[model samples]
Target: MTMYSTDTPVNGQDQEVPPFGTAPIPGSRGEEKRAHLQARRTEDRADRREAAEERRRDREHKRRMKTEAKNAKVGLALQKKAERQKLRAKRRKERAGRLVELREKLSHHMPLWGLPVVLVSLAVGASGQADAALAAGMGWASGGVPILTEGMTLTLAGLTAQAIEQRRPHGWLMRATWATATGAAAINAAGHYIAGVEDGADKALYRAVLYAGASMLGLVLWWIVMRSKRAAISGRSAEETTRWKRLARRHPVLVRRARRVVDNTGLSLPEAYAMVWQRANGAAPGEPSIREIRASRRAAFKRTQAEAWDGRTRFSRTAPAPAVVVPAAVEPEPETVPELASEAAPELIPAPYLPVALAVPGLDGQWIAHRVPVHPLPAWRPCQEPGSETATTRFPQGQEPLPDPSPDASEDEDGTQPDEAQEQVREQVADDRLDKARALVEQAALEGRNLRRHPSNRQMARHLGCRPGTAREYLTQVLAERGIRR
Candidate 1:
């Protein structure tokens, strides 16, 4: 610290001055200046603190808004995902139901399938393998006929082939086999319990009789199935067959049947015939009902008609009807006459006379007073004067009046020749005209000219002395003959 000096002089006087940092002597200028500086510094620091706080608040508000927007976006994405999952689940459920229905239908065909199995079992039983099958508890029919087991297995195999041919899903055949096996097991249990016997020979005989009866029953059922299948096949062929050359020559009955099928099925003749042939040969499944087929075809046709070239689909069936624009009713014009006078006068004015037509041959029409007043029709126009512009006559453009035949000219002795010389002249003229027309056609073709325009047709007709239609036809034929495409 420096020492204070109390001996400083000012303005040539002996006044003493205080130290520099000490509070100025009361009423001095330095004391007031120092206090003013202290207040300004404090104000500046306070202003800076307020500005920083405002900036922090502004940053917090922006961060809050950004977080809200992100949350909203995430929520929307999740909602869409949930809706998509719901739609997919619904579709999957519907597909599963259809699959179950299809499997049930396959299961019902088991009896028809058992026919061939029964036949095979009979042969295997005859070969004495029935005993071995029965001992193994795999076959209960006729003391375990080998054919019994083989027939069931064969039927399962046929079901598998049918499934594959029908383009069913992978597990269809497996489901069918399981259903058939269950059915066979049930049959075996029923037979074993019902045909109980004490002696071995009697039991074997009973079993043999039981097996034979079942086989016969299965055969009858098979016949029914075949008959139905035949019907289906025939129906399909009738619709598809339009022309069956071999059938026409060898089987007229089949042709007639095909026509009937066409009428019933509403299919093209060729398609019906093909389907019938497939059914007869057992290469196709049973035909659907006629109603179902027609309904499906109608739906497909509607869809086709409704479709546009663009990928967006317009569902016409569900589309709302267009709103009709009904014009607002106009107020009737006020009567020109005063309301009091119009109400006082009678509304109907009677005619003085009405013209009545007389049917008598010699009588002219006469007018008479009518019992009732007649209202005239709304439209009225003055009659057109004869031979005036309003009464013009229109005719076809190229028409010409025919010449009167001469009474002096008569047919020759054979009654076939009226004018041989004139006929020769006409033929010569026609030949010359054709030659000129050919030249014109060749010239036009070389120039790559189109003859379809009205002016072109008219010009050609004028040059050839023919009607425009005739000229057009000639040009068209020439173009075709020359292999020139339009």
Candidate 2:
């Protein structure tokens, strides 16, 4: 029981030994392996946490910088955009006046100075012709007006038969005498009517006589014209016979019939006329005169053309090559042209073929028929796609078939792709923006369901990353794009 301390003093330190296995669960060869692995794991986890914190800080900085850059761009872009809009508005106000000026410039057909002058010249010429006719009439009634100027007297004389026949008082003398007598009486009657304006009977009588003078001239000219026409027709028939003989020799089919008609009948003009008449009516009059034959020949010629060229279908060539046949034309014959009833036309008759000398003032000879080949129009070839073997509905849309690509568009010698680098960049940027906007819209839409249908538009705009008005426009555009009705 007496205290006797059994502890012994060691070095100057608190030296205490742990119990057998309670210390740190003592390490062995295998236990040391586990210790190293646990220590490594603790170190790795600390490094990962620091790395994650650095990445988050970096992302925050980048986001702030991007926001600032986009805000800066918005101000610069909006100012320029406002200037453009203002210019467009101002121009819109002036557009109506510009359109009016353009329309007026395109519409007026004539120059300011030209139209009135043409109208005036036409009026003056018409009046001058009428006045000349009236003055000529007055001169004729006043005993030929010997006091007239040379040109005026000539003009007046030309209006009557006296000057037309070389101013002779004979040969068609009856017509001129009649005109002179009637015209003179009219002048005498007018002289008697000068007392007062009683009934103006003398004026009326003078007018009638003046008309009679014109009528007498017209009648003589008409008779001469009829005679000339008959003579010309007779002469033409004779010419045709000679032409037919030449043409007949070149082709065999008509030659046989023509030779028989010529040799068997002697083919005098009168006999030819009779034969031609018989062909027309299927019978000839007994001992027909030369005139009857001429009439019949013309009728038959016209009838033949009707049967040959009209809808009877003979006009068209039946065989690919026209059949060669002898001509039926008669040999050339001496046929006299009867004199014209109107004597004046005969003066120019001999020179009629010389168009420059004999042509009426406005006539030209170019209208004469000439032989030429006429080709038929080409057949239409429908467009067909290769291999498909079906004609394309080429005009289904309002587009012409694409012609072959131009030579300039051929591939380059180097085989390099065409440079669309800028377009690629724009498209890539658009894709990125659209993806981000879609993500934002989806998030906003989910939040709206938890809140209300019509959220703050500005809040929605912020989610869209666009201005309020732009967001409104986009909303409208999207609804339309979705084909939604209001």
Global lDDT scores for all candidate models: 0.53, 0.45
Q: Model 2, range 377-444, lDDT digits (tens) per residue?
A: 34335675444233432221233443333325655476533333323444554454445444544565
Badly placed stretches (over 4 Å) of model 2 are 1-198, 201-206, 209-226, 229-234, 238-486
Cα TM-score per model: 0.26, 0.15
**Residue-level lDDT for 22 in candidate 1:** 73
Off by over 4 Å in 1: 1-84, 90-94, 97-223, 236-486
- lDDT, candidate 1, at 39: 64
How would you encode candidate 1's per-residue C-alpha lDDT over 83-181 as one tens digit per residue? 999999999999999988877665444443564665554453333344434545665465444346446645765655454445333255556554554
lDDT at 75, model 1: 91
Q: How well does candidate 1 match the true structure in TM-score terms?
A: 0.26
